[model samples]
Target: MSSDALWYFARGSGVVSLILLTVVVALGIGARSGRPAFGLPRFAVNLVHRNAALLSVVFLGAHVTTLLFDEYANLRAVDLVVPFIGNYSPFWQGLGTVALDLLLAIVVTSLLRHRIGVRAWRTVHWAGYLSWPIALAHGLGAGSDADTWWLWTISLACLAVVVAAVVWRTSAAFEARTDRAVRRVEPRLRAGIR
Candidate 1:
């Protein structure tokens, strides 16, 4: 493929990956509430979340592979895995590397959740939250299209989705706690206990 094609492919895949990752993160947060999403059952929501995550990984791989092959990038194999070793924009590139490593860990643990036990898997899964922001920052700092209006719009939209999901999750948790407390207190008050 021509260098131009490779570069365009890399950028396209990266953007798609970011959008898919945002969906995965938002669905994950919403799933925690044990509520259906967009009229889908809880199981369906989970299925969509899992599939979106897988798709995001596929796009991420394509993005990385195309970058490696793109003559303009001039990236070495080691640069993909090692943080801050790239010729251009080392810090931003390093963030991408870190996000990649964290995502790999999350994927591995998820695949091995049964063998590793829930606690261990859950611990690693928490890294997903951290990885999303790092990946976003990397895109903003290192991406050629970062300065473009459309790219900023897409990025900001992704950020808004995640933030809204987080807020929903927290409010759901708080409501659950309040309900439980009310349940406990009502019985105690009815029984004449302070």
Candidate 2:
């Protein structure tokens, strides 16, 4: 394909990847509550989270592959793994590289969760929360369409949803803790303890 086609494909894939990543993040937070989301069962929410994550990976690969092939991008293979090494906009590209590395670690640990154990897997999975914002910043700083109204709309919307989901998750966790404390206190009060 032509350089222009490759560049366009890379841009499109990158945007799609970002959107899918957003979905994965929001669904992941929702899944943690062990409650239904978007009228779907808990299992369905988890299923969508897993599938969205896989799709984001596929699109991310496409974005990188297309950029590597596009003559205009001037992206070297090493730049894919190493942060801040690209010829064009190194800092912005480096953010993407860092996010990619984190994602790779998460995916690897997830595949080996059974062997590595849940505690280790959970630790690695937490990196997903970190990667999302880094990836978002990378897109804003590195993308040629960064200033476009459509890109801004999509990015802002994604940010809004993720932030909302995080707030909900934290509140739910706090409520659970409060309930446990109340339960403990109730029993003590019933026994006439001070």
Candidate 3:
């Protein structure tokens, strides 16, 4: 209803967007692990990941829209498309724009995945790994409450969750590969080919 409310909304939505992005990334890693997450099936994990990603986009839209409307930030339309051009916190704001660009690319490619082929879709999707960190950096650097302890706590939690997921995924992949290799080699050894 007022500028103050708009500012608060922007900040709140930005935080929520970051949280949602973290969930999406974690769920993606879980999906790759070939194991169920939270006792849920792989398909369920995938569904949650897709839904969380969409929700992040929604909150991001709110964050950007409110920032543009809030006169204090002095955000320009160009700032949304082109990174680093904004006079207000240029570097930090630019990182947010870059993150947004990467996210949009991933979303667009995902939507057109059937047409783009699996390789192209997967290559673009990998940007999710990069997007989350850029977003976290933007929040820490550009956010007005960056210095707050609560924000730090939340950021750390997000970081921990993602790190754990990645570690789990990597180990699972290695084990699967090792199992396949063992299977192949064992058959050859039994046949006296090794």
Best by lDDT: 3
> Where in model 1 is the C-alpha error above 4 Å?
172-194
Local error of candidate 3 at residue 31 (angstroms) = 1.0
Local accuracy of candidate 3 as per-residue lDDT tens digits, 42-127: 78999899999999999999999999999988999999989999989999999999999999999899999999999999999999
Q: Model 2: runs farther than 4 Å from truth? A: 172-194
Clashes of 2: 0
lDDT of each: 0.90, 0.91, 0.92
Put down candidate 1 lDDT per residue, 25-118, tens digits, no spaces.
Answer: 9998888767666457889999999999999999999999999999888778888778998887899988988999999999999999999999
Q: Given candidate 3, what's the lDDT at residue 35?
A: 54
Name the candidate, 2 or 3, with the larger lDDT value: 3
Candidate ranking (lDDT, best to worst): 3, 2, 1
Tens-place lDDT per residue, model 2, 54-80, is 999999999999998988889999998
Worst 10 residues of 3 by lDDT: 30-39
After superposing candidate 3 on the true structure, give the runs of residues whose Cα lies further than 4 Å from its correct spot.
172-194
